[model samples]
Target: MRKRKTPDFLAQAHDPADPNPWLALYLDRSTPLPDEVKKSWLTDSSSNSRQYLLPLLRPIARGFIILIQVLKIFLPRKWSHSRLLHRVLAWGLTRFVSPEANWLILRHFHLGAQILAFIAANSPVPITTTPLEPRNIDDLKDDLFVKHDLNLFNFVIRLNQALRDAGVEMHPPARVDFSMIRDPGLRLEDMPHTRLNFLDLQSAIELFTPLYQLMLTDNDFWRAANSLQLDETIGIYAARLMGAPEHLILVNNKHPLVPMSTLRAGYRLVLHGLSTEMLHSLLMDRKAAQEQPPAEI
Candidate 1:
């Protein structure tokens, strides 16, 4: 039997030179994110990005949303929850999704879990459920992402820090365990070594369309994986109660349009696919760090 090679995600995780800046927000925040980067993520915009295309894509997104809505009327309400559907999605993800992409997707759930738990713990009003499992994201079935949303991970971190400054004790999420990602259930090792170097927005839309549609039908798997939208009402309410600064408090205030929301979500989702210039920068930074000579003792 041929020797099994280490997966890109495993190597990337263990690499001493962390390439992705966003990871710092959750994994290590000793270094603050730059203002421009922070602004860009807040608005989901950057100089070289394709947000300009949303105008053209909106009508198409509206049409697709309508079609999915119509199709749902005819299909089994829970058809998206089929175990086989998830299996097929998992197979494609492991084989075609880049290591960085997979890493982001898996990490998002962990981060989201932490934020939800933190919010639940400190909310002025009581939360009925404390969501620890990533799957518990299905609890967000009533919420939705809108245009120009704040990155939830960023928002939570800022809120936590703000609350601490105001003399409130905070409940931080459990430390992330990268090793758990190698579990057989996740199948991260199955990814090919020669995965694509770029992740485009269209590719993300194509990849997530079926899952997104299924999510709309209230499928647990995709809803948990893709539709983890934070409730603006709850988030804002909590932020105000906790005395977080107006600057630190943020939410998806844009009106919901399923098609446009999906496209906007797809735009953000492409980052999970590691297709953005920032992701490329991370990979390049890691490579450069690896190639540098060891420092003398």
Candidate 2:
């Protein structure tokens, strides 16, 4: 008897409609910005002066940012598990800057940087030493699957676990079974059989939105800290000071448009705002769950 072929679980999990369309919408490059936001982002002569001044003060800023990044790396892991510390950090960060800026910066600057880096790194590069060698598109696809797709899958899994710890129970849509691949340690070849249905997309969004909000609330402090800018200056300065990989990638790739940072910042604001709204809804759900009567046997 011939052995049956192993199914492509990843392909089976592809949903054109997307079980959480908001995630895609939030990530999309074509999403439009509001008029007022457009105006706010426009920098004048004063803005240019401030931007120029930032580099002169970079030595001082660099030291301060590095200290903060160090604290962020170490302190969060050590203290984050504490409920009090979580609340305190959340409260402090929320007040440190405008919520508007917080939302804008993450969607636009942070996520954009991550996406661009992923694209550039995964895109085909010439084998400069062997000029005649053909570019391998297969390698590019494999890299994207392993680096981008797998990493995102694991992130969503982790995010779900974090929500559960906070007393909010959320699962992917019934039509989409992620259980087989839920193990964080699972390798690509070890990936189990699963199915994804785009018809159940709305339900998945409804289920996941609360958890997404919790994530935003949890990261609000860090977001606020990173979102700060002086006029024309982009937050890439702070990222560079902290030795962020995104800055290095951007430099290496030589991305044609510096203004993409501005666009990214604007997009982040909208996405963050949406996440904040979701967080509010999640709180309400938690409250309702707490107040619910015990189930009859």
Candidate 3:
């Protein structure tokens, strides 16, 4: 009999496969900053974007900002200088200087930074990252159908089958979103916009956390984490039956853009955020049946 594989969380990266597969995005030469601005900014550790955009108003903003000492004693830290100053500066920059702030910078510079800046300038910036991230269900499909040979839906079906053979059955009433991939931008079709404006995608990813984790388990995540640490992986995997390799193999898919290892980890992390009850509902019916009802004797 083949020895069963158990997950080892710490062993996978650098030595083997790191599931995040940051290599693609990390090593990409493309940067969000414009070519001219990228060169000037990357070289300067202390490049003050405001220094260039609002030189005349900097001194006045500085004085207004110092008033933060008084605000600190009365307001939340979020409203303090470190965070609030940027907005105060932006307000002072745009209002006292630019009058109209540049949308291009506001979108690309990072939302929190821009948000504080907008608040400082007392302006409102439109949020653009939503409607761009793939839904949790779509994310699975993107992994299986777009990135790999088996469609994610089919891949999940296989996982359910493997579990059934082990005398474990996933529950009823599954929902899926299989919309034709739409680019939030005009430039890309179905592809995640090469120019997704959010400086950090985590905020967007958080929205689906509950649904993401409804399908995964702590053990599943630990295994996926291990897979990332090990280069032995071709893709990512999570199973309702923690001990089932067949189920694990079914859920994780291998593809060029999203390696099996990376997507597996991504999906697992998304699941990590889901309510454990969601996973238990699908995986625990037999266990639930065997349990005796609360007895009062």
lDDT (C-alpha, whole model) for all candidates = 0.39, 0.29, 0.27
What ranges in model 2 sit over 4 Å off? 1-32, 43-61, 65-89, 103-297
Q: Residue by residue across 128-157, what tens digits does model 2's lDDT show?
A: 110011122122222221132234334334
Q: Stretches of candidate 3 above 4 Å error?
A: 1-53, 72-101, 109-297
What's the lDDT for candidate 3?
A: 0.27
lDDT of 1 by residue, 199-259 (tens): 3234435555545565535444233323324344334433443443341223333221231
Better of 1 and 3 by lDDT: 1
| TM-score attained by model 3 | 0.18
The digit string of per-residue lDDT tens for model 3 on 1-297 reads 122122232343543554433323333443322232222222221223233423443343334334433444565433312223233333332322211112222222232122222112211211122111332222323222112212222333444455566664332213211121111221111212222122212222222222222222333322334432321121122132132343322222233234343223433432322212122222233334435487798
Candidate 2 or 3, higher TM-score? 2
Off by over 4 Å in 1: 1-66, 76-78, 124-193, 196-202, 214-231, 247-265, 268-297
The lDDT-based order of candidates, best leading, equals 1, 2, 3
Clashing pairs in 2: 103-268, 103-269, 104-268, 104-269, 107-268, 108-264, 108-265, 108-268
What TM-score, over all chains together, does every model reach? Answer: 0.44, 0.22, 0.18
lDDT of 2: 0.29
Q: Give the 10-residue window scoring lowest on summed lDDT in candidate 3.
A: 122-131
